[model samples]
Target: MTPFLTAYLQRIGWTQTPDVSLETLRGLHLHHNGAIPFENIDVILPHEIDLSDEGIFQKLVVARRGGYCFEQNGLFERVLKEVGFTVRSLLGRVIIADPPDMPPRTHRILLIQLAGEPWIADVGFGGQSLTAPIRLQEGIEQATPHGLYRLQRNGDDWILQFRHHERWQSMYQFEMGQQYQADFVMGNFHTAHWPTSHFRHHLLMSRHLPDGVKQTLTNFHFTQWQHGQVQESQTFADVAALYEALQTRFGLGVSDARHGFSLQQLEAVMAGFAQHDEKA
Candidate 1:
């Protein structure tokens, strides 16, 4: 057992040995959402990424930092295993807000078996997801703090949905399957290095709140949402202000000259967005 897991468990207030039952799994999911964060600074920095248990343990547990889906779900899987839950890695795609029919398989998530039923447990997705595990059955609405989410069947894949203004919207579709670390390494590299990948062009960070809300920082904008309503939203004027917000609001200790996206570059990027939007 690594000290990372020990420390994480302690931080989550789970001093007792973890149980693999549904109740325990729910508790773990809630704890994860409330404590850990979802971030992509490592991706932006083009940091050496690894999917091994030890690698995830070091990044999330030892460093007391957060990561994107791959890193977050990777570590969460290991923690579940340590706690006696049956977990497996599953590949997923990002369904952008536009193009209602297109889904790109560039993301990773987790499928866990707890209490004899398959549950989708993802601590990696920053926003619009369940903080607790949900059953994989089709058309079954699982009530979560984020919203009432459901798994809808689509051919061989399962589509995750959230109730939005009394209707369901497809979030992402995933298959219950096994994947190895090597499978993710290629995609991770592409996303981190490829010019077209959004992660390469944007600065993103998110942290789950104690009241089931989520705080997100994207480019120069900071937004906090609770139960799907925007609680707070603001924009920074410069990179220095952005960095200050990251450290003060997100609890991140990032140096202005760190390995990831720099303050100047981020400001320029945000300026470009504003320009583009104004043009439109």
Candidate 2:
């Protein structure tokens, strides 16, 4: 059996070497976000989601498939452990549409111990999550290309806050406690295959750059955000166009069976978003 650590370093685009440092960690995060992509195509494809080390290694390192939170963070933690970093799987809830509500168990994250303090290192969150590890403490802000971020304690759990428009907004909540890999397997399966899950109902991919730029695709529209401004927005009319963009622009490759959203479906979804915006 290949050592889990070796497999993880390869998965993150690093060859097995003795030189590991904080800079290496940062480079790994940047390399992952740039190369692997943050995509939910497996969800729409209804593909089998696996949380095992070997399974994740094959999909990410061998097949070069991109995945959502559980797949991304799950594999990332394995690599950190292999590199002598103390790693623990944690659960988080996204606060995109709601505020201050307890999120579901589906959200998976990592608590990494380095330099005698635990830090948050997440590679799975689609957009605007910390692109590098941030120290887990209260009242201290860590600046990144995306924005200024800080972790605040709320009783037993923690809230990740992002500075936007000169104010802090709660991005997500996570607990520092231990979470088993099997716990995420059920969630991974549910998000990938369940009809009611949002991942199953939509097509989405996103990535954050080191310069604080973000590229995102939802349904048919592609958007690029730079320096807090939307630098580009384009809508494609066919699956071929979307697939081409995925390959050429995003560096993602997957089986054609994963393609599910057509132009018509994407248009309908965009229309729903327009209606929601109008109502708001």
Candidate 3:
């Protein structure tokens, strides 16, 4: 096994190299979600999102900080490759925000073919990330630890939907065209630099917890939910409170000193969310 793979396994709390199988894939997906969080703090911290393998390793495993799609799945893709999984990178358009038009394909998704059966596995997608590998088929509600999800055909494309509020809501859509590292580079740049990209404005972070519980931070609001019901919710009144949640709940810290993320910058940006929450 490669050094990167060994370190990655340790980071995700795995003791030994897992065999290349569906069960291993599912375990890694769930453990990755629990150990490393989904966060867009780099974009909010005003640092460029680095998509290189070494850069991803340093930020995620070495620094022990969470990241958005590119960093999160980029690191996972390498680990899977090292463990002998036939993984393919794919791009998807995120429609969870219900944007007026079909937005750019900014989301980095993964497609794995194990024993001729296709499975979609993702440890990214903040808050609503897939907790296990879902079948890449149409019209069937695949039950995961978190909830039920289904994929539907949209012309020649496919859209992933999940059960919520007694309704299936669209999360993302994509065709089967395979993606490459360059595609993620472009997507990461757009996600970080695009002025209107939500990553620049919102402090989005999430992690899957024990027994169907999910923890998320959207701007200044923090929520803990279990099986689609809110168990606890709080809106931070100050950056100190928000910082506490990020550290204690999500396990992120100021580990990447070169990234220059600090409490002061956090306060400067999250001030907007604090004001917005007060008005709402």
Candidate with best TM-score: 3
lDDT of candidate 3 over 75-159, digit per residue (tens): 8888888889899778899999899999998998888989998889888988889999999899999998898999999999989
Error of 3 at 248 (Å): 0.8
- Whole-model lDDT for model 2 versus the true structure? 0.73
Q: How well is each residue in 1-280 modelled by candidate 2, as lDDT tens digits?
A: 2476565566556653623467777777776776677888655554577678877777776676778889888888777776677778888777755654565767788886677777788888787766887778898989766768888888897888888888888878877666776778766776676666678656788988766778898777799998778999997765667767877777665543333334454344455444543455
lDDT of each: 0.73, 0.73, 0.86
**Would you list the clashing residue pairs of candidate 2?**
none
Model 1 scores what on Cα lDDT? 0.73
Model 1 agreement with the true structure over 57-107: per-residue lDDT tens digits:
666665556677777777778788887888888987676365556645667
Top candidate by lDDT: 3
Candidate 3 clash pair list: none
The window of 10 residues in a row where model 1 has the poorest summed lDDT is 252-261
Of 2 and 3, the candidate ranking higher by TM-score: 3
Better of 2 and 3 by lDDT: 3
